[model samples]
Target: MAPGYALALAFSVALLVTTDAGNPGLVARITQKGLDYARQQGIIVLKQKLSTLHLPDYSGSYDVGVLGNVDYDINSMVVTDLQLPSSEVTLLPNVGLKLTVSGAYIEIHGKWRVHYLFISSHGDFELKVLGISISVGLSLGSDGSGRPTISTADCSAHISDMQVHFSGGLDWLINLFDDTIASSLRDNLQKQICPLVADAIQNQLEPVLRTLPVTSNIDDVAAIDYSLTGPPIVTAENLDVQLKGEFFERSHRSPPPFSPLPLSIPDDHSLMVYFAVSEYLFNTAGFVYQSAGKLIFNVTDDMIPKDFPVRLNTSSFGKMIPQISKMYPDMLMKLKISSPSAPSLAMKPGNVTISPLLDIQAYAILPNSSLAPLFLLNLSTDAVAKLGVNSSRIVGHLELSSITIALERSDVGPFPVQILSFAVNYYISHILLPEVNDILKNGYPLPLLDHIQLSNLMLKLNEHYLLLGADVQYE
Candidate 1:
């Protein structure tokens, strides 16, 4: 298959197996934060109008005549003191959201122009609106770029009490017709202002969502791609978002055979992420190791005392010597190590295992003559690991619990030396494990989308995948 095609196929397979379902509480928290942020910005403008107004003769205003063909223009409307109570969100079947905004108060300032008797009278008006409520029904879907978007289906707004204050030449006229003016304003606002608010929300929110960094690159070596599969689900308690994607290294190699299948979502979590381990991700590590060739560790004579004594006690080697001293006390030992093959990953309940084959060789000069082989060993170790996530990044640690040494003839000895097993195991446990941990310590940085972070992260491992879940909090 073509490289791009292969990559796409792999991603599809990964998604089929990996299901990253969201938590309702986390969704609600994120939505609330987003709303709070919008309120803080405080610059939404709503322009509405009533084309014409008809009135009978005014009773009090300077012997006014019948008012007909009165046009009204609300030049600008700003919302303040807007509050969203602890309202519930309901997901319309296969659509978007049934949102409720209750106990909201807004202070609006606008200019109203009225045309009456071939004369236009303009006035600056201030309205203190109380007992405001809004209900919106919309569908959440993705745009061309895979960002979440909203399509309004229905919207309605209600205002129980509105105190209107007016200025300019028409001020006294409006005061005289306060009740009529209020009723007209309410009718116009319900028809025009409500829909405008809904549209304004969509316009403000969609762009912000699109700009979020859902996909992230890690140190130019690997990348985590987050692509949405469908629109978010809104429920009475919270919102649920589903994400599917894959992680791949720069090498484009596939993961080893043991890569796990995706796991299921955990129960009652504020936020949950279910991820499948891909062959590409595991093989990438091997490719990087192979490209670096061999790693050499030099032990100088100064590091080891001249009278250093080593003991060998194993079933294979028995007790050969009580203590063996180095013949060439001043010489240095060079240990060369390399991974002969790629590493494989397997997921177990609450842990993951990584197995890699290693080839190790050590050489040192003897007092009598030339350099000699101290030992040569081939082995595979299973490093079981666990991951922890913080606000900034994920951290991992590994423990080598199983080791299998492949016996082979070497110049150093006629039989397999027990000391070689101990040496290789020590190198893997003490040296290799820490190096892997360090790499994991600098793991993928969590993207802060719109100043929101995943907090209190927890992990669970299953037969085929790892599940990461967390609560949502503002940074």
Candidate 2:
């Protein structure tokens, strides 16, 4: 709520500061061109802030020798028009940002009251401020909670011209000391410009930046944490930020057992902004779901196609494994399939893949309405993921590439495990993959400000990381 990060913080939620560059699960880069775009938007806000500048009513009593004692007060002062025709934002190497506004203009209308030798006259006056210029330096950092923080490094302002006009009063008497009155007015207005700019940055823009969401809800079951892992990295051409891109269950929020590997993205400046995402993010989702027991699926006859030639009964499986029919005669079987451990995702050049170790337990339904253990098979499979950007989310689908099945244990005597491979593969292909795809269809929200939208996206996959470059629009 206090003075914090500046315009860059709102640019795309992609701003940073100084900290040890460990392996970051997520990294955001803002190119110089991005800063250029932000500068244009910043000028509009700057003008609005300046238009609200309040100057204390000026009152003074002076003796002009021949004029005796002259008392004057300027009140009801209000800014009528303000213009910032030109401004520039420059990134300071290893420092922060420098913004300069030149050729600016302002006009103020006020009422003037003058008392000269017991003769009181009141009238309206206009003050025109011209050739105004301002310079501000802003530095970005992180707060104790890893949210970005911005503060004013330095500021300066200069006013080259000020003209005051008086009307509808004793013009002859007022003109006698017009120069003196204008000098005092100019001094009062000039001294407040830089301070007002600083106040706007500290009291106004800073609060808005602090409101930038550091974490967002993905769905009812899971939430993602995009909290800064450390301060940002400042380069001559880019401002880089690192984040802990991990997901946790909605009810149980805890860190995953695995740590992120070193992540690096190409320094391509063609795009305005870039995001580097590591596999740690997806792995954390796997960990959360696995821990919450959401990764398990129960496959029964109803889950299979009704028109399929074979059912989930022992009579159908007996054609291959005769021992099953001899022992249970005819009984419906169910497969309780689940992952043995958290699945891990691997990113490579032009590809992303995940390998899951699933445990499938076979059971037979008895007349007593209870499950009887039959066999347990371990399934290992590789799946390729196709990822795309939808609005501000990352959506993906998985395709099974290869699978291998091995018999871990059997309660109904030893039989060729390969005999059931066709059936098991069918369940994974038709049943498991479809369910996984449905979840992915909802997609995951990217680590961006809620109001920011991305377009013209280009994706590049590298070892251990994927870089997403896109142009952003701030709503």
Candidate 3:
């Protein structure tokens, strides 16, 4: 789920809790719903690193007393059956992994060729090895480039049942060499196979894991850096990983927020993300808004229609205003508005409030003169909006809300700016509010990994951080 949607969902839940007598059951239901979604997405399923093992062929030449340096080759050597006990996988927190596979069996059937001093013979061979098991310990580290790396600390293999058979070769010679060949092969395999398997896993699997992308892009808007903070933790049922990074944009760059308190792993959720919303994010947003300046709408006498809410009520400003208006050939007025301060955001039950110090300046154009400021007013307004997602972009919808004007400013002492409350509210509802929403319509996009995405996500707002919970899903 996207963070925008999560924030909205969390707000809804908060509303229920606050308005519905704080029912614990409803909160539990919401959490359970998130968990169910996670399960459906397959985030709860544990993935195994090594699922199958295959050995193609093993061939060598051996010295036989009477046969005088016999050469033998075993073709099509394969093992397809393997098992892993539920308790065999263990995790060492901030460390590595220990895995054990037991009760494995290999039914081997292959062709063998043997060459004597002057004679060559070929035959079929059948062998069954039962009660096979292996135990391996892996250590996690990092390569020179800071990518994850895995190395084998210890490995051992055991074989209990060994049966061998041969056909077509002379019975006497075969019988004489069968026991010796089997014994020598078993000893050599027992000593060498474990290290070879370990090497293959480290060399082949490590690079794939390390190359996994940790950064996410959102077209031309922004890029989120999600580099891993440390190596992943592997346990019996799942793997846990953590990321700590920041967002980057061409026009806006700010230092990351300070780290919040450590997160507690929750058993009910398969995945969790913690975001610390720093002062930098808010300050950067403010800078962007200030740089854009004010929005203006022009009004003309002829533009007013019959249904227009605005009337030419010069009677309120008295006879002098009407006389002054008559002297100007063309009368024009502009309502210029700007938010001088970047909006400060706060969260409540089912709502997010953005309060920005607004600077409203009205202008009038006199004949043959440049636009002049008619009036200047400074006040603060709270714009409430709801979060959502649209076409992969996080958006906000403004709500019909009231605005409060700040009258404590020293410069506006004794002035009746409060009388303009209705006009300010109207302007915000129709214009300023939409502008703020437009700025927020492109909220951060969710991070993704190829075909996988986070499912049924929810966000929780804390004093200093934003907590996200969800499950993984593969397309």
Using lDDT, give the best candidate's number: 2
Model 3, global lDDT: 0.47
Clashes within 3 Å, all models in order: 4, 4, 1
TM-score to native of every candidate shown: 0.63, 0.88, 0.61
Please state the error at residue 382 of candidate 1 in Å: 2.8
Q: CA lDDT, every prediction?
A: 0.50, 0.76, 0.47
Inter-residue clash pairs, candidate 3: 1-454
lDDT per residue, candidate 2, 107-204, as tens digits?
A: 98988888987699989988888898988999887877667777789888888888878887876666677778777766777788778778777886
The order of the candidates by TM-score, greatest first, is 2, 1, 3
Residues 223-252, model 1: lDDT tens digits: 554545456655443344544444545545
| Residue clash pairs of candidate 1 | 254-279, 255-279, 255-280, 261-464
Q: What is the lDDT of residue 415 in candidate 2?
A: 89
Q: State the RMSD for candidate 2.
A: 6.8
Local distance difference test, candidate 1: 0.50
Query: How many backbone clashes are present in model 1?
Result: 4
* Model 3: residue 242 alpha-carbon error in angstroms: 5.1
Using lDDT as the measure, name the better of candidate 2 and candidate 3: 2
